[model samples]
Target: MKRIPLLSTAFIFLWFSTTAQDTLTLSRGQCEAIFLRENLSLIAGQLNIPMAEAEVKQASLWPNPQFTLDEINLWATRHQTGGKEVSPPIIGNWGRNQQYAVSLEQLIYTAGKRKKLMALQGVGVEKAQQYFNDLLRNLKLELRRQITELQYLQLSEQTFQTQLQSVNDLLSAYERQLEKGNIAAMQVTRLQSKQFELQKELHELKQQNNETQKELKQLLHLPPQTFLKLSSEQFERALTDETIPTYQALVSKASTNRPDYQLALLEKSYFEKSYFYERALRTPDITVNGRYDRNGSTMLNFVGFGASIDLPLFNKNQGNIRKAELGIQQAKMLSQQVLHNVETEVAASYKSLLNAHAFQKGIDPKYLQRLDHSLDAHTRNFLSKNINMLEYLDFLESYQQNKLSILDAARDLNNAVEEVNYASGTELIP
Candidate 1:
């Protein structure tokens, strides 16, 4: 029940045991590391946290005070001009008869509105962070699927290539026999047809593999024409069934660890804070102003203070308060729905893992290798006239189909583990 520890030199040795000189051999640990460090979408998601924090900072700040220079005459007449005024000096004292006025006002929140806004923004920041975590969850799932799929396809591709070479050799021998009059043209034609069919199927497999490779390339941030080689050799055996947690334990872990679930709970809190903030808006803000006059009022130099407030009779933020209350109710309902979905997903994913595990256990690890060696013997016997070509072809087809099926079983097992990881909102396998 021991794993290879995934990151040490032992994994490197395991991966390179069958690796080619020019191909990149990667294990699960290597792929996971590359995905975390290089995924474009995840890098972009990191920016959201700082932006949400800026919103929190903006919410906590007070509005700047307003200042105004009111009704300053650019050119005064001879009667209103002060003594010897040649253009006004930029930094000198003001002229008494210039007929200028100034005013200042400051806005003040009435009912702890600033504090309420700060709290709401704090909730917004938490929501943004959870959203980022959810993004990581989704993209990491994609990464695991791509890596495992490429490994499976690579194994299949190797089998096909080997069979393809054998078919070519047989066709060449048939062509030589026809030329020497030992076999009829019909024999060579049949061998040629088989060769063509093998080629067509191999090409089709390559096309499917190319599509997966393109996706894998993006996930790994590799450049064009870079061939990816994956090492899934360590996962060839049947998965161990022991140590799986119970259904209740899995659901509880998902509730605690799932970002989407956390986001839903945060949404409810956000709405509750929004309701309070909206209600605080009903008290109306206060603006206090001071005014000054020169040569315009009955008193030669006058200064006075005034204040203003919007009457709460008509609008008291009634619509916003109702909207916030509705938001609170809506968030509560959605959170409950998310909780239900989490339980459902965990159970379904676990069942899928069990099915895949059963399939893997039913397969014999030596089945494909034994069949392949037997097919090679059959192929040699047919070449030596000890067996007919019909028997050889039948065994060849069986070998390909059986080997491909077992490869598919291995892939299903790995994919099932990824599904459980996604559902549990934690790396269960690791």
Candidate 2:
């Protein structure tokens, strides 16, 4: 791998440490590092793991003891016997009066239900972590694709703007010539139409560039209107792999590394555990009770301990057990389906990568650069009447089109590498 430039490192830590300003320039490595640290979606994904763990904690906890305060009369009823004076009881005679009874109940787990529930919730946490990893993987792929696209768009836009500037200058000069009766008005009109066409195309590409940048900014959590200056240096780096990995190797690595596959396996395990938990529910929880009454029992300060259990006469969690069993089969089928999909995607992306590599290998970049250099001389010659306008325009258009093609080829190579890495669930490009 190439080392990141010192300036890019500084900018990544300094400018990108917070919300970006009007313009931000970063190398691919810097951008990816910042993304790992600061991307909002990744942050949300990470947060979910803790939440799942919290659910596990909740599952392992014993149910809170239920406290009861019964037979608490709001007002005392005075019993007037033989017209004797009678009064409502005050707070001091709480024990002697028959006004209040208190009890406490605790749900005791049977059949290791708490442990089984905790185990089930543990699987849920694993699933959350796997989902987070999958999200990070996907975003990394998207980031690389965005970086390559923006680099290509920047180069293409620069070339078009430069040509547009030159055409505007020529149009101004030709307008002056027409006023002096040296050039026809119809010729100036043709030049204006060509300029308008170029402007329209440029505008459309600009909108596309903005849309890509906006999506990238959302990932980085940057201010929406901030300008993204994607560095072309990383895109220009040559592919260093001598050969691609075999299909079997990629598929095997994907089975091990792909979070989606692992997540599916975890889902299957979770459902299996859930089936156990549901079956455990058939053994109804026991509720033990301890109570104290003021004066109801013949014995003073009566204290009692009792227990209760729901008889499994009708509902025995039969429906939930069936659902859990069905869930296991569903999860198994889905895992297998994911394996098939990953294999197909890896094979297809490998084929596409091969085509992109062959196309890029055929192009000679330095030769194109020299040819592009000759374009300025050609344009100047045409303006000086040393070359015909038709020939000059033809060569200029070809130059523009060829440069766009070269940039597109680079983009294709970069995109293909990212696609393959994503599908294979490994960083094959690096």
Candidate 3:
């Protein structure tokens, strides 16, 4: 063999390690960690927490103080030398020519407006937190669903391949029988046609398997060409024999643990705080002013302080306060709506789980195993001229179809349980 570059060999080894590490023979906890660390949307959702915290900080800060300076002239005068009487003084000569003044005024109170604003900010932070948690839960559920689907598809593909091989063997036997004049030409042609159909179906399943892998990779945010293989035993153990919670218990759990409901409650509180803050606007804010003046001629300085407060005489913020009150009402309505939706979803998902479980129970593994053996016997009999080609093909097709259906049913049951867990805010996986 030609010498492989040292760098190339190292790269190959590194690639294998990286890909293998990413393969993730995932447990429920491992799936949760991957979502927390790698899922882009969930990571982006975390930024909202800091953003809301900044808003709270902003709400707690006081307003900047205002400053003012003034100058007065004290030695300027105009003289009129005419036959008419002169004015006493054209300009003031007793006031300061220049003055420097600075004053700091802090808001004394705003009738609990600041406290209300801070409360609203707290609600915002809570809402952000709830949203992030909800996103994490939803992403994990979807990932589980896809993983389960891929497992089912892989199993189905194997079943189809095995069936295809058996059919090929039977077809070969039939051709040999035709050569020996033990079978009609038409019978051999029919067997060939059936084998062709099975091959076509096998090809389709392979294509589907490829597509499923691509989807799984996309969900995991891994490179498209990554060589990932799931451990079937691990997957089966993850979902097998799960004990579902009671409906009442699930509803209670959702009320406490579901993030969307918590978010709605936070929003209602935020709007209520806003209402109170707006109502506090009915009280006017006070502005205090202080000034100092100096005269150039006598170097005299004057200082004075005064307070100014706006009268709510013209506008008393009636419209804005009314709007805020309405907002509180709206938030309450929305909270009710969210509660109803959660209850409905929990009921529906639980029902689905029950139906899927029933279907799974209805399937008899022993009966299927016996039927599979029978189909194999029939196939062999057809090859040995004890049965016809048509009967062999029919038995093979039926056996494969039944096996595929069983696999699909099993997968559906797993997905339904995941759905129930997700809707009820239960940690079924981890």
Candidate 4:
């Protein structure tokens, strides 16, 4: 019978939407597993390996043989005297329509060209495999990063909701007191305005959470309705010790362990092989042919074999050989560049981990709890006229901000550790 106000209806709708989303209960390992099993990009990248292998098999096959029919002759003659013409024609005894021979030829050799081609195809397969490995590493790291971000956002949103609820309750009490003429209408209006601001903040946080959830769903290759609830406790446990490898150690580990750098090394080797294979192509190719002939009338048979070869006088494949050599040089340069980048990344991530560790150590949970209790006491005192409203509000604001900062710092530390592990090409867990 009663209708809700527009703002109230809107708030209800927002709340229901936020709560109705599916929740995935996942740890970090579970998150990584889901991406490995489900992410479409990784799946597609994996398919490239088989595709390249098929190419290698195709390249290894020899060329098909060629078949030829040599000659078939038909004769026609007009005779002045039929008898004389027939006798002349009969001189080529038993002249059936003449048929000569059939021949077949297969390429015998290509001066190691087939070997070079197969080598090139083998390089292609190696490159594809290395690329797949690189993709796998990047995909796992991205999944971990996204899950961490979502967990942090959820925590932030929950804290904001709690603060908003507290503010709303206080505003409702103020409204009641104002109706009884025990509080000024201006005071009630100020409290109501604060409540509205908190609601706005809560709405913004929820929107951010929704966006992150959508990204996680996409990463997991799940439908939009799929729920994701992360294990915050597990994350907290993961951040317990905060001990990390030194910068030099991290660099060394990354150089040895990072798949991207290893892939680059493999690519360089492939190019080196390609350059040599191209140089080997300067040799000429030889082709051999064979044929057989038979005449049933005389019971005579003959066999013959012949060969041909390319001189390589004009085109020595000089341009292709030079290009392949240049490619080798370029690959080496790129390998060096990637090594430098990996070292720099490892150092940077190590520093970030150290800083995060120090920042987290500076946070005291008990101190925050005490401050929360004090802020609550101050609010009660303000209601009883023992303290001013400004002091009470300031204390509440400071307490809430401190709580948020601590949670944020914790999440940052966890993320920093993840970064260190990612850079060093290792797992943070275990």
TM-score of 4: 0.83
lDDT of 2 by residue, 171-196 (tens): 99989999999987887887788789
RMSD of 3: 7.6
Candidate 4 — what's its lDDT? 0.72
TM-score of each: 0.86, 0.83, 0.80, 0.83
Compose the digit string of candidate 4's lDDT tens values, residues 1-430: 1222322454335335655555446667766665666678877788898899999899788888898876533543444334343222223565433335667887754557677778878878877877887787776767777787778777777766766766677787888888899978888777777777777877887787788888888887766876677777544433544455567777877888788888788777777777777777787656677876543224335578898878888998899888878888888899899999998888888788778877887777587678667856776786778976677667667766887787778777777877788888876434
Give the top-scoring candidate (TM-score): 1
Per-model lDDT: 0.82, 0.82, 0.72, 0.72
State the weakest 10-residue window (summed lDDT) of model 1.
Answer: 1-10
Off by over 4 Å in 1: 1-25, 73-94, 234-238, 296-299
lDDT for predicted candidate 1 compared with the true structure: 0.82
Tell me, what's the RMSD of every candidate?
Answer: 5.6, 5.4, 7.6, 8.8
Between the candidate structures 3 and 4, which one is better when assessed by TM-score?
Answer: 4
